[model samples]
Target chain A: MNHQKREDLVKSVLFVFSITASLILLLIIIFLFNEAIRLFQEVSFLDFLFGTKWNPEQGLYGAFPFVFFSIMATLGALIIAIPLGVSCAVFLAEIAPGWARDATRPVIELLAGIPSIIYGLFGLVIIVRFIKVSLELATGETILAGSIILAAMILPIIISISQDSIESVPKSFKLGSLAMGATNWQTLRKIILPTALPGIFAGIILGVGRAMGETMAVVLVLGNSENMPEVVKQLLGKEGSSTVMQLINQVPEILFKPGEALTSAILLEMGPAQVGGLHYSALFALGVILFCITFVLSVASNYILSRSQISVR
Target chain B: MINSKTSDKVMKGVFWFSALLIISILFLILGYVFVEGIRVVNLSFISDMPKNNWREGGIYPAIVGTFYLVAVALLFAVPLGVLTAIYLVEFRKEDNLTSIIRISVDSLNAVPSIVFGLFGLSLFFYYLKDFTGGPTIFSGGLTLGFMILPTVIRTAEVALRTVPLSEKLGSYALGATKLQTISRIVIPSSIPGIITGVILGFGRAAGETAPIIFMVALNPTMPEFPYLFSQCNALTTQIYYLTSEAISIERAFGMAFVLISIILISNYSARLINKYLARNIRR
Candidate 1:
C-alpha cells in the first residue's frame, strides 16, 4: 500500500480501538442502568436513600445504613492510613538511608501490586480470627477489621504519591529551611508539611477512593451483616467498646451479609446474585455512588495539586 | 539548638516508626502465608485434581488455566493497545479527539474492577451469551482484555513518547517511509516502555478477581488444555474460593502466598526484560 493509504489505515485502526475503550465504558453504564431501572420502578428513590429498613423479601429498600457504614469505615481507614503513609513517604524521600530506601520501596510497591483478594485472604485468616478470639465478637467481620485492612491496601497508594509530592517540593525548600537555622523536624513540620499537603491530600484522596470501593478485602472481613442503623447502635452498646468499636457497632450488619440487600452488592453477588434482582440493581447503584465519589475526590486532588503548584511558583 | 535537635529526633522517630510499620506488615503477611501455604504446596498440591477433601486438593488446573486465560486476554488487548498508543504518540495531534481519548483512558483506569465484571456479565453474558453458549473463558478474557486495554494504551503511549524525536527525523532523512520509521525506529526505541506497560497490565490481569468472577463463574473441575474453550479455574478464582471455604483457611493463605510470589517474580522478570532491551538499545 502507498504511504497515504497505510497512514489512513493505521489511523482508522487506532480510532476504532480507542473507541472500543469508550464503548466498553458506555456499555457498562447503559447495562447497569437498564437492569437497575426495574429496581427504581419497584422501590421509591426516597426509600432507597432514607428509609431505615432494608428487606428484599418485603420489597423495602433503604441504602442509608449501608452508605453510613461505608463512609464510617472508609473515613476511619483514611484516618489511620494517611498519617502512616505520609510518614513512610517522608522517611523514604527525606530521611531514610539509601540502602533502606532501596530495600523498602520495592517491598512497599510489591505490597501495592498484590491483589486485594490476597489482602482479603490475609485479613480473613489473621485479622478476623484475631478479632474473634480476642474481642469475643459475634463474628470476625467488623468495620474495624475492614478499616485496618483497607488502611493497609491504600497505604502504598498514599505513600508513593506523597513521596512524589515530597520529592517534588524542590531541594531548595529543605536547604533554605536548614540555612535559616530551622531543625529538620521544624522544617518538615513548618514548611515541608504545608508545601506537600496538596500532593499528600491528593494521594490520600486516591487512597480514600480505593478504600470506599474496596470490595474483595472488605467483603471477606466485614461479615456481610445488614442490620438497620438503630440496631447497629444497640449492637455497639452490647459490644461496649472503644471509639473504633462504637464505629464498628454503627455499621449495619445487613450490608455485610451475603444475601442482604444493601451495600457490597458487587462483591457478594457477582455470580450467584439472582438475575434482575434488587441485589443486582443495588450493586449498580452502589457503582454509581462509588464512581461519583471517586470522580469528585480525583477532581479535588488535581485542583489542590494545581493550586499548590501555583503557590510555589 | 535544643529545639532543632528535638525536632530532628521526632522526625527521625516518625520516619523509622513508619518504615518499621510497613516492613513488619509485609513480614507478617509473608510469614503467615508461607507458614501455612507451605504445608500443602508440594508436588501433590500442584498435581492433584479437585477432590471433595480440601486437604488433598491440587492446583494444576488453576495454574494452567490462569496462564491460558492471561495469554488469550493479552492477544485481544495488546494489539489494540499498542496501536492506540502509536497513534496517540506518533501521529495524532493534540486536539479534541486526542484529548477525548486521553480522558477516556484515565477514566478507564479508575473504573473499579467489579464494575468491569458487571459490564462483562451484561455485554458478554446477557447480550452475547448465545454466541458462546453462556460463560466461557473467551468471554471472560474478552471482558478482561477490555478492562486492561486502557492501561496498555497509556503505558505504551508513554513508552513510545519517550523515544527521541531525533530518531524519527533521522529515519525521514534516510528516505524511510513513515511506516518504516515507526516500525523500525520508533517502536525499537520504545521497546522498554512497551514491555513495561505490558508487564504491568499482565500483573493486574493475572491477579484480577472481580472482573472475571462473574464472567467465568463456576470453576471447572478439570481443565482441558487442547480445548482452550473449556471453562477452567484460575489462581485468582482459586484464592477467592479457598478463602470463602469454611474449612480452607490454611489453603487460602497458601494460595495467597503463591499468588503474591508469582506477582513479584513476574514484576522482576518484566523489569529484567526492560533492562535487557535498554542494554541492547545502547549497544
Candidate 2:
C-alpha cells in the first residue's frame, strides 16, 4: 500500500481502538445506572441510603451498615498508613543518603506492584491468625484486621507519591532555612511540609481510594455478617433472643467473626447467587457505590496535583 | 530549641523505626508465602490437573488460562493503546477535544476493576454472546483489553512526550513527514517507554481475578486445542478454585507465589529495559 493509504488506515484503526476504551467507561456507568435503577424500583432510594437493615433473604435491604463499615475500614487504614507513610517519605527524600535512596526506592515501588489478591492471601493466612490469637477476643475477625491489612497495602502509594512531592519542593527554601541556622527538622516542618502539602494530600487521597475500593484482601478477612445497625445495638445490650441474634448465632463462628463481612460480599457470594435476585442486585449496588466514590477521589486527586503543578510553575 | 543530641536521637529513632516496619512487613509476607508455598511447588504441583487432592495436584490449567487470556489482551491492546497515544501526542492539536480525551484516560485508570467486571460481563459477554456462543477468551480478553488500555496509553504517551521536541524539529527540518518522523525517530527514542508500558499492562493482566472470574468459567480439565472460542483455565482462576478446597491452601499459595514472581520479573525487566533504551537514546 502507498504510504498515505497506510498512514490513514493505521490512524483510523488506532482511533477505533481508543474509542472502544473510552466507550467501555461509558458502558460501565450506563449498565450500573440501569441495574441500580432497577434496584430502586424494588427498594426506596432513601431506604437504600439511610436504612440500617441489609437482610436480603428477609426483604429488608438498607445499606447504611455496609457504608459505615466500609468508611470505618478505609478511614482506619488512612489513620494508620499516613503517619507511617509520610514519615518514611520524609526519610527517603531528605534523610536517606544517595546509595540508600537508589536501593530503597525500588523496594517501595515493588510494594505498589504486588497484586491485591496476594495481599488478601497474606491477610487471610498470616495477619488473621496473628490477630485472632493476639486479640484473644471471641470473634478473631474484626474490622481492625481489615484496617491493618489495608494500611500495609496502601503504604507504598502514600510514601512514593509523598516522596516525589517532598522532593519537588524548591531547594532554595531548604537552603534559606539552613542559612538561618534552622535544624533539618525545622526546615522539614516549616519549609518542606507546607510547600509539599498539595502533593502529599494528593497521595493520601489516592491511598484512601485504594483502601476504600479494595476487594480481595478486605473480603478475605472482614467477617461477613449482614447486621442492621439497630440489631447490632440491640444485640450488644440485651441477652434476649432477638430474631436477628438467633439467625446470627445459627451461622458458623468462622463466617461471622469479623462481625460484618461487608467487603467480600461481592466477590464471595456472586458465584452462587441466583441471577436477577436481591443478593445479586445488592452486590451490583455495592459495586456502583464503590465505583462512584473511587472515581470522584481520583478526579479530585488529579485536580489537586494539577493545582500543585501550576503553583510550582 | 531541642539540643543536637536529642534531635539526633529522635531522628535516628524515627528513621530506624519506620524503616524496620517497612522491611519487616515485606520480608515477613514474602517469607511466609515462600515457606508455605515452596513445600508444594514441585513439578507434580505444576503439571497435575485439578484433582480432588488439592494439596498434591498441579495448577496446570490455571497457568495455561492465565497466559492465554493475557496474550489475547495484549494482542488487542498493544497496537490500539500505542496508536491512540501517538495520535493524541503528535497529530492532534491541543484543544478541548484533546483535553476531554486526557480526562477520560485518567478517569479510566481510576475506575475499579469490579465495575469493569460488570461492564465487561454485560457489553462484551452478554451483547456479543451470540458470536462466541458464550463467555470465552474473546469476551474475557476484550474486557481486560479495555481495562488495561488506559495504563498502556498513558505510559506510552508519557514516553512519547519525553522525546525531545528538537528531535521532532530535526525530522521536520529534513523534510520528513509527521508519520515518518514518529515511526523512525520518536518511536525509536521512546521504544523503552512503550515497552515498559506494555510490560506494566502485562503485570496487571496477569494478576486480575475479579473482572475475569465472572466472565470466563471455563471447564476445569484441559479443553481441546484449536478451541479459541472455548472456556479455559488461568492461574488466578486456579487460585480461586483452590481457595475453596480444604487442602488446596498449599497449592494456592504456591500458585500465588508463581503469580507474584511473574509480576516482579515483568516489572523489573521493564525498568531495566527503560533504563537501557534511555541510556542509548542519550548517546
Candidate 3:
C-alpha cells in the first residue's frame, strides 16, 4: 500500500481503539443497571432505597441505612479534609520554599499510592483502637473512624488538585494585592484564593466523590451499621456526640451492632448472597448506587471545571 | 482570617501543621508496617507457600500471584492504551471527538475500583464465563487491565503530545509516511514517557484490592505456575483474607509491607524517570 493509504488505515484503526474508552464506560453503566434493576422485581425500589432495615436473609432489602451512612461518612471526611487539604495546597503553592515543596511533593505522591487495604490495616490497628480508647466508645469502628481514614486517603487528591488551582492563579494577582500594602497572607486570602475558588471547588468536589467511592478502607473502619440514624438520642447524651454516642446511648447493646455501611454491606453480603439469587441482585443494586454516585460527582466536577474555565472568559 | 494581630503566626502554625500532618501520616504508616512486619519478611516468608489458611508459613503463592495478575494486566493494557493514546495526540491530534474521548477516559479513571469489580463480575464471570471459563487468570487479568487502561492512556497521551511538532513535520518533509514517522520519531522519543505511565500503572494495579477480588476470588495456590487458566491469589486480597478471616494480623502486615514497598518503589521510579527524561530533554 502507498504511504498515504497506509497512514489512513492506521489512523482508522487507532481511532477505533480510542473509542474503546467510551465503549467500556457504556458497557459498565449498562451492566450495572442490568443487574441492579432486577432487585426491584424482588423488592420495591422505595423499600430498597428508603426503608430502615436490610437483611437479605429475611428478604428485607431496606438499604436506607447504608446509603445514609455512606453520605454521612463522606461528609465527615470532607469536614476534616477540606480545611486541611486546602490549607496544605495553599502552603505548597503560595508559601512553601522550593526545598520544602520538593520534599513534601514525593510524600504526597507516596501517600496517594498507598493501597486502601493498607489504609484499612492502619485504621483497624491505629485509628479504630485509638478512638476506642481515647473516645471511650463502645466500638472504635464508628463512622468517625471510617471518616478519619478516608480523610487521610483522599488528602493527596484534594491537595494536589487544589494546589494546581492555586498555582494556576496568575502571579499578577499577587503583585496587584501586594502593591496595595497587603501582607502576603492577606494577598493570598483576598486575591489568590478567591481567584482560584472555582478550581478549588472542583477539587473538593472530586475529593468528595473519592471519599464516597472508597470501599476497603472505609469497610474496615465504618462500624458497618445498617440501622436508622439515631440523631437525637446521640446528641442529648453528648458523651461522644459521634455515632459512638448513638451506639452507647441511643441503641441498646441489646440491638445487634448496626449491620454494615453500604459498601461493606454489599461486600459482606457478596460472599453469602447466592449467585443469581435475589440477594445477589440486591448486592448488584448497591453497586449500581455506588457507581451512580461517583459517576455523577465526577461528571459534576468536570462540568464545574469547564464552566469555570469558560466563565473566566 | 488573616487580618488579626496574631493571624500571621496562626497561619504559619496551621501551614506547618498541615505539612507535618501529611508527612507524619506517611511516616506513621510506613514506620508501623515496617516495624510490625520486618520480623516476618525473611526469604522463606516471601518464597514459601502458605499453609493452614495462612495462619502459618509464607505467602509465596500470593507474591507470585501478584506478579502474574499485574503482568497479564499490563500485557493487555499497555498496547491498547498506547495505541489509543497515539490516536489521540498524533493521528486524530485535535478535534471535538478527541476531547470527548479524553474526558471520558478521565472520568473512567476516577470510577471507583469497586465499580470495576462489579462490572468485571457481571461481564467476565457471569456473561463471558464460557470463554474465560470462570475467574481464572484471563478473567482477573482482563478486569484489572480495563481498570488501569485509563491511566495508561492518559500517561501515554501526555507523553505522545509532548513530542515536538517540529520533529513530525521534519519527518514529513523527508517524505516519510505518518506511520513511519511515528514509529521512527514519535514512539521512540516518547518511549520514556510511555514507560513511566506503565510503571505508574503498575503501582496502581499492584495496590488495587477491590477490582480483582471477586473476579479471581482469592485462592491458596500460586497462579501461572503452569497456566493462566487457574484461580490466583494477590498480596492485597491475601492481606484482606489473612487479617479478616484467617485472623492473622502479623502475616497481613508482612504481606502489606511487601505490597506497600512494591507500590512505593514503582511510584518513586515513575516520578524519577519523569525527572530524568526531563533533564535529558533539557540537555
DockQ each: 0.61, 0.54, 0.70
Worst 10 residues of 3 chain A by lDDT: A250-259
What does the interface RMSD come to for each candidate?
2.0, 2.2, 1.4
Candidate 1: regions farther than 4 A off: A1-5, A231-263, A270-273, A299-313, B53-55, B217-219, B223-228
Best by lDDT: 3
lDDT of 2 by residue, B1-283 (tens): 8896578669757965786688678878778877887887887777778665444567787777788889888888888889889888877778887777777787888777767777676666656678865578777877788789898999999999999999899988999877899889989898999999999999999988777877666346454555567787777766766664445677779998888888988998998988887898767
- Model 1 lDDT tens row, A1-313: 7889988897787778767776766777788677767778877777677655666656676666677667767876888898899999999989999999998998897888888888888898788888778877677677778878889999998999899888888789889999999888888989888888888988888788777767778777877666744545454354443576656654545323322222365667545557778766766766666666765775566567667777766
Order of all candidates by TM-score, from best down to worst?
3, 2, 1
- Candidate 2 residue-pair clash tally: 8
- For model 1, residues B144-183, the per-residue Cα lDDT tens digits are 7887898899889888888888888998999998888999
lDDT of 3 by residue, B114-146 (tens): 888888889988899888878877788888898
Error of 1 at A155 (Å): 0.8
lDDT of 1: 0.76
Q: What is candidate 3's lDDT per residue for A1-313, written digit by digit as tens?
A: 7877888888888888889888888999899889888789877888787767677778888777787777778777898999999999988997898999998998898888899999999899998899889867788888778878889988998899889888877777789888988777788888888888988898888998888788888888776756555552344343345766445564433122333566787777777888888888888898888877887888888887877777554
Predicted structure with the largest TM-score when compared to the true one: 3
Query: What local distance difference test score does each model get?
Result: 0.76, 0.77, 0.82
Residue A25 accuracy (lDDT) in model 2: 72
Worst 10 residues of 3 chain B by lDDT: B217-226
Residue B222 Cα positional deviation in candidate 3, in Å, after optimal superposition:
2.0
